[model samples]
Target: MIKLISKTALLSVFVAFSMMKSQSVKEILNQEGSFRKDTIFSIKSDSKETYLPVTIIKGKEKGSVFTIVAGIHGYEYPPIVAVQELLNEIRPENIKGSLIIIPIANVESFQKRTPFINPLDGKNLNTAFPGSSNGTPTDQIAHLITKEIIPNSTIFLDIHGGDASEDLLPFVCYYNRKDIPENTKKAHDLSLKSGIQYVVSYSYTLTPTEPAKYAFKEATQQGITALSIEAGKLGTVQKDNVDLIKTAVYNMLENSGNSVKRKSKMVNQKSIVLLNQQDYIRVPEDGIFYSELKSGDKVKKNQILGYITDKFGNKKHDIVSQTNGIILYKVGTPPVNKGETLFCIGYNE
Candidate 1:
């Protein structure tokens, strides 16, 4: 069943959307028929003040609340752009469930052109799950989603892509939370429904007692089915990648009976599941990295994946793959920092 948003919490949200009145959320959540509202939720702290752009849509019949969040890593443009485009494609009248869309979760980082972490508090918004109310800007934002949105949603998808310095292959991932078997099954089922062919999963490093670190992980911990969809590369918007997100999200929504009937059918792809955790090469020191291989390149055990050099172009280290696997992602730019990932490999064996 689709849960309703808290009436008290809805009033605290400041509405900045020109088309929506401030009372829309309260009115819709209290007794909803069919409504779609565009609004903004503000997060303020002593040092940071930013707002999230949100779109809430409900169908005539009540169903699951399917939430889609993009721009947790602000530099990733494709998913962000895809979500914005989705806003235009979907209408409330045709939907069967509620949709809580957060197009750009880190507006501050997006505006400042920051990558990986929030520019305001130097925090990775994805890592700050179940955040503190009095914490940093990113923390407050996470808290809002965890407290306000996650509780009201039945299914969630957090979309991401390669940051400015990284190139990544397209894949779909969900947390392997064995403690919650039923929820895990739902999440895994959603990953397979994603249009992406490469399906991967991450096991929880933390125990069931601990709150998860990632946004989708937190949703899983809270009993909501969630997934993380990755695409695009090197911070640039690729039309193919953008369309992939569009197709995957709409496909998932359509399957869950939350979206309008469409001619585009859901794809059943040949899923390549990486059986092991990602084997990564991290730099020992700041240097310039050179690699001819891109994401999806195959590598053999002990093969020279790349080389790192001192700033003056003298080789310092020859990066080698630890196992035979396919490269999932790599730092795309030249400048490398100590402990930064040079390459990430995934394997079935």
Candidate 2:
């Protein structure tokens, strides 16, 4: 009463079904395997095509997706180098999920050693987030990040260092939100996992321009855990400083999920949550600055932090602090202009 097909016929049918399923998986879902692919996200025009390199690494098994980005300012060489070296060190077989690393976010700025703004669009890439597709090059790149990268990521890690003229001690920042308690806790835990010296929390403050436009800000708002970590000083890259950032990143990757496993050697570090932006000490006039205080120095209210003198060394003005705090960052260069920021102080207690 039953019909049995020939072995050859049955084998052919099985092969056909297997091929169909493979094609469907390839077309519909993200491919599962361990491999490295270099992709270019392009913003096209009539004359040229500006492209940003995105490195994609997918592990054998599916888990959480973590994205690490650096080189937004170009001159922040420490994070850039650390991310670059990650390509060689990270083994896909040992990872449980995906890893996307954009070593140089601003190619134009990185090529020209420009600080802050992209030379092509004359825009700060950091501030131009959740960007416009039809806008400048920087904005387009930001758009790609918001649209293409952040959406696919479970964690958005923004790495930075002191620019060409900034000197700072190492620190980590996590967004704080009272309304979204879970997100706030995740972000805080991410910061603490980095094992950095200082940790700052950003809360909501009504202002003319909102902070919701930033890349990390938008990421956190969308229920993703985001962190911005910083180290190094000035534009020059030091091997030790680069290693410090690299270690912190490895720590994050190891603890994020089943990405990798290693011995836990993280030290217990103290953190301070910055409630407001009242600790900035800006220059009063154009002058040459001489400061005995550097980043990490503790100060009291009304204490003279530094002295600024005229070119001829005749007129001198003492730069004083308005609150008791620890110096977060100081100007690396001696020359300063009126209204320029000289130092930023963090809450002491």
Candidate 3:
């Protein structure tokens, strides 16, 4: 196939190749001072792109990198607002490390005030971590976060709160992976330093098909210190909750030796571990639910936490607690479907 090509044709081929390479490398963030960048991530199955708004604050002096993520559930507004405040309040020149903040992880859901799974893929972004490049929309976002963002961080914070349809007590969680002793201790320490009232040692009971795919879990699996903090309530952006979240970020930064004025002290906090399926109570059938219990309330085993009454006003099921623990979260809305989570309880072994 020895054919003579024109100089114009050769130039066109080179330009096309260069453009492809440039698109592949797509710069996420590159600056030494405070800046904001917006990116349209082309990771959706329906060929739609997700808007990832990022805030970067690079210190004048070189130090460790910390990444903070919020709005994984989209409808959780307090953590999202807290991240936005961080972008505005932090002085990059005064710090020693870089801070990368993603105020809204799921823009589509956030815009619509949707809860849980992505509308396009029907996948929970939290459970779709370590995702595939060719998978669903949520999966692709997870893959990008795991592959690109998490690897660049020495420590990562996955901040969250109750979605628009949920009500929950504030708590902070870190994965308890005994296999990695060094990172495990650091994660535990970070949890205590997070300025939250309750610290939960969370470990997944993985099956053959479902491994650990949560944001903090997958990040910690890669040897990065990670923690998850839950604050706010019922999809509302309360200032007190936002301030609590903001304190955690600054606390972690100070603990990690960032050039902050005050270091965070380890607060005396209650801790719990989730090791059984009974800890999570799910709706048994489709009905309108009425709950007498709220988050942080202590309940006894076999106690009736709430009752589900059908549309006709007949009680269909009695929501009961299977473990002697404190209520961690509950559905805020009365309408619920079968198998939907109604309440999460935290218990000690």
Best candidate according to lDDT: 1
198-299 in candidate 1: lDDT tens per residue? 877777667667867789989988878888899999989999999999999877887778877672554556654654467878898899889999998889
TM-score of each: 0.89, 0.84, 0.84
Cα lDDT of all candidates, in order? 0.82, 0.76, 0.75
lDDT of 3 by residue, 190-210 (tens): 777777777788764444355
What lDDT tens digits, residue by residue, belong to model 2 across residues 35-122? 7776555554334345667787778888888889998889899999988888788877877788878889998899988987888878
Better of 2 and 3 by lDDT: 2
TM-score, candidate 1, is 0.89
- Runs of candidate 1 with Cα error greater than 4 angstroms are 1-30, 208-211, 266-276
Give residue 265's error in model 1 in angstroms.
Answer: 3.1
By descending lDDT, how would the candidates be arranged?
Answer: 1, 2, 3
Model 2: how far residue 90 lies from native, Å: 0.3
User: Where in model 2 is the C-alpha error above 4 Å?
Assistant: 1-29, 45-49, 206-213, 267-278, 314-316
Candidate 1: minimum summed lDDT over ten consecutive residues — where?
15-24
Candidate 2: residue 210 Cα off by (Å): 4.2
